[model samples]
Target: MTILVMGATGAQGGAVARRLVAEGHSVRGFGRSGEVPAGVEPVTGPLEAALDGVSHVSLVLPMLLERAEVDRWVEIVAGSGVRRVVFNTANRIPPAATDVALFESRRAASDALLASGVPTVVLRPPVYLDNLRAPWVAGRLAAERVLSYPLPADLPVAWISHDDLAAATVAALTRDGLEDDVLDIGGPASLTGPQLAAAFGATYEAQDVAAFQEGLTHAFGPEVASVVAATYHWLAKHGGDLYETDPTAAERLGIRFTPVHEWIAA
Candidate 1:
């Protein structure tokens, strides 16, 4: 069976595509950049044509898609003969509506996909431990020996790795009886800022939320950055938990998570 992976050139999707390839599965990677894993067959032409003969899909949308764009994607996928879809929402879903554009847009997409007459599984992941390796954060950590983030000092986060998240996606795609389910996945342990910093033998600094937003604005445009930053800003004021300490759902699926220290060392 051929599995179609969207955004397979990006970090999360790249991990999924690589893992699937290593498992001897036939993988078709569709990405804007056209750079897929070594073994993946790149979908260079139309996506609709690429969906033909595909059995399952790993759907990873851009961080900021408009509601209409999300709907359009669901419409397209619904018509495809694919049997299953595993969508990575790429962030935490709020309990109630926080009115943050990014979160709400993703929520709407999840709802649309589940109701699109296709067997779909939505995976919501919390903050990624991989983010620490990004240039902006990594550079500072390397230079100053500090772990700075826009989270409260006491807030505990069960940071997940992209590879672990990829395993969950693969499980959701291959496993049965998970249709129309929304799962919140996380790492094994939830650590506070101090504890997380200690993993790298670095000092912890609570970065200002506004300053964090400004950094995002510089990297991503102001429009996307504003919406993305709004979630963190809301979290600062509302103090909603970003991760599940237990990760019971992941365990039930037989998905294993990498430890933070192990990831840091790697």
Candidate 2:
């Protein structure tokens, strides 16, 4: 089988592309530049050209793109003879949070893909355990042994990893009988800040909204700060169940994942 993976340079898309390659499927990595992993073709052309002869298309939106652009992608994929499209969201929010732009963007993207009449599988992965390895947190985790973030010290989250999300996406892409399915692919278990720190051999520290926003504003400007701060603030109010693993997809795919500690250590 042949596949085109958008956002292929990112963690999620990168994982998907790599997994497909391991399965011996032809893979194309589509991103803004020519960069891509080994053993995959790189395509940096018009959407139509990228979709050429592609059997399947996988995507993880890099950022908030115009709805019209995504619509066009859907239109092209619908007529391109593509067998399946897997769209993965970084996180999934409750329906009540639709008013928020982040959640609305995902809902809008999902709607377009499903309406395109092309077989599609939407994957909603919660907070990733690999986030702890980010520079802002990883350095501190290594040097000071403290896990810092703008989250409550007690909020439980179902943290997943890139590997787990990719496995599920590949299953949906290769297996039969999963067309038009929206799956919440979470981690093996739910965990809190203190509990998360225990796995990392670190202590937990609260990164207040004020401090978090201030740092982000200085680094990325006010728009990003406001938007990101709002998300963390929202999570602070309503704790992140990112670590709440949903078993529906895993059960269907006949797959299982390592626990939070084991995944992190690996």
Q: Per-residue CA lDDT of candidate 2, range 37-124, in tens?
A: 7888999868789888899988776654665776676677666779899888677756565445666677777887888888998888
Q: Give per-residue CA lDDT, model 1, range 95-208, as digits (tens).
A: 788778778878888888888889999999888888888787788888998999887878878899999988999899888789888888888888998999989889899889
Candidate achieving the largest lDDT: 1
Regions of candidate 2 where Cα sits further than 4 Å from its true position: 239-243
Q: Give the TM-score of candidate 2.
A: 0.91
Q: Give the C-alpha lDDT of model 1.
A: 0.85
RMSD of 2: 2.1
Runs of candidate 1 exceeding 4 Å displacement: none
Write down the lDDT of every candidate, Cα atoms only.
0.85, 0.79
Give each model a TM-score.
0.94, 0.91
The local lDDT score (0 to 100) that residue 112 gets in candidate 2 is: 79
Candidate 1 clashing pairs, residues 3+ apart or interchain: none
